[model samples]
Target: MTILNSQHILKNLQELKSFWQDFLPHLNDRCILLMSGDVGAGKTTSVQMIAGELGMRDVQSPSFAIHLRYENAEGKAMDHLDLYRLKDDDDLESSGFWDLFAQKNSLIIIEWANRLDFDYLPLNWQRIEVRFEKLSDTERKITTRQV
Candidate 1:
């Protein structure tokens, strides 16, 4: 079943962390979280919150390196990927994109997912589309839906 489809007005980091705490457990084992928004829209910060919930304390945007992998104490892995540097499908393929997606027991959070071709998305895998809207300097209107 779909976990979240509502919008939240997050005014601070605590609220954001709470949001992830409330939502992360409900995510599927092989979740593909498509995070989309403009630059500095808190996409990476949201992933950081997810990582924190997953017991990965040190989290950062993988924009430069393109991908980051973390594992919790229980061995639940989380792959954080940034596709902003990829030009097209071929670029993604050449960068071992499919290999990353093949990983199991992991929640893959993709920043700048809108830049990637949606047609390549696997049909059977669980997917969530998270869109962030900057409501103010300190507030973000975040929405989620199953895909």
Candidate 2:
């Protein structure tokens, strides 16, 4: 199910906030948000904005840590992952990527999700794939769909 397919100029915070408003309704617990985009394409920024909207503060890119867990005021968990450094399934295993699925209530958000193989995902899991395309220095084309 394609939930959002739109483009926006993300040059300022207001534009990003507007985009978050449009994207927030489709988000839910116990789902995986797979994001793919070139470096500096706003994938992590989008996550930060969404996390802020969810009452989370100081959300940072998990690029160095590979994975980071956050909790909102309501105790909802969101797992942020960056797969750019992972090379293979062994690395994923070592990073505890698979274990995240066991957390039924956490929202898993993966950056560099193009590196992940979809076949390994549980069939019953709800997955949302979001793709970001850099149109210009301040614009991005964001497409999202449930898969």
Q: Name the top TM-score candidate.
A: 1
* Model 1 TM-score relative to the real fold: 0.91
List per-prediction Cα lDDT, in the order shown: 0.83, 0.82
- Model 2's number of clashes is 0
Cα lDDT tens digits, model 2, 68-106, are: 999987898889999988877887888888888887677
TM-score of each: 0.91, 0.89
By lDDT, the best candidate is 1
lDDT of 1 by residue, 19-134 (tens): 88988878878889999988877898889888877788788887777878898888988888898887677776776768876776678899988897667888667888899888
- Runs of candidate 1 exceeding 4 Å displacement: 1-3
> What TM value does model 2 have?
0.89
Query: For residue 121, what is the lDDT in candidate 1?
Result: 84
